[model samples]
Target: MTYLLICCRLLLGVVFLVAVTGKLRGPAAFTAFVSSVRRMRVLPAALARPAATAVVAAEATIVAAAAVPVHAAGVLAFATAAALLTALTAGIVTSLARGGQEPCRCFGTADTPLGARHVARNAALAAVAGTGLLAGLLAAPTGAGPLAAPVDPALAAVAAAGGAVAGALIVMLDDIVALARPHR
Candidate 1:
């Protein structure tokens, strides 16, 4: 269970870090993300860029919190992750309800158009975060409580690496889908 919790934390951290890095790849990349946010049509045009920046900043914070092995930080990070995923899911739902066709600026470079997949992905992430939050609270504990059985350091390290690799593969979903599509 300890190793599993570490795996989940690392997996989610890597995913969010990759997402932020992709969007911040260049000015054009960020502008495209902002444009995608605008296309969501959830906010006034004047607020789109600011909203995008805020979202990116929030994701960066999540990466930092989730990646660093700060004591008791995992609990907070999981909660934050859950909230972020929920908000993202809401945005996707709103876009879908409005019949939006904008590409999900999810991985920055992936041109995967918004669809049911986005909602499913976000919902899945939120569930992971929720579960992690519960598990982390018990495993890591707050101040002055009995700790769970310690995890083997070597095994934990391996799990961490595996989690990161899993995240990278998940981000490549678009490319994988593209390759599988029949050529025009």
Candidate 2:
């Protein structure tokens, strides 16, 4: 349970941090993200900028919350991440239903248009977040301090490494898929 919580926390933190950095890397990158939001048509064009800003803010918050070692904070962070992923999945589904082929600038500017793969990826992430939240709740310590039980240093390091690798793979999913696809 300790290792699971640690892995989940680091996985979510790394994912959110990479996402935030990709979007905010530069004015052009951010502009592209805003444009992608507008193209989704889930929200009115007037709200695109605000929506984009809110998304970035939420991702940033998740990263910060996950970084905290407190048991309560981990629970809250996982819950927030799950909610965010659910919302994102809904948006992607809605866009696809409307026959929108807008590029998903999810991890920065990319030409890959949104598709079922994006939905699947988001759903998987949401499930991971849900699992983490459940684990955190179930493993809550009885003491006043909500800190988790100390894990063996070696095991903790392994968990962190595994989480980081998973996060990186997720972040690069699009690129990996593109590379694997046979060129016309």
Query: 1-184, model 1: which lDDT tens digit per residue?
Result: 6676777788888889889998999999999999999988988989999989988988888888886675456777788889989988998999889998889898787667888977877887888789888888766544442224555779989988987887777677677778999999
In terms of lDDT, which candidate is strongest?
A: 2
lDDT of each: 0.81, 0.89
Error of 1 at 174 (Å): 1.4
Total backbone collisions for each predicted model: 0, 0
Q: What value of lDDT does candidate 2 attain over all alpha carbons? A: 0.89
Each prediction's TM-score against the native?
Answer: 0.89, 0.95
* lDDT accuracy of residue 133 in candidate 2: 96
Q: Which portions of model 2 show Cα errors greater than 4 Å?
A: 143-146
Error of 1 at 62 (Å): 0.9
For candidate 2, which ten residues in a row score worst on lDDT? 142-151
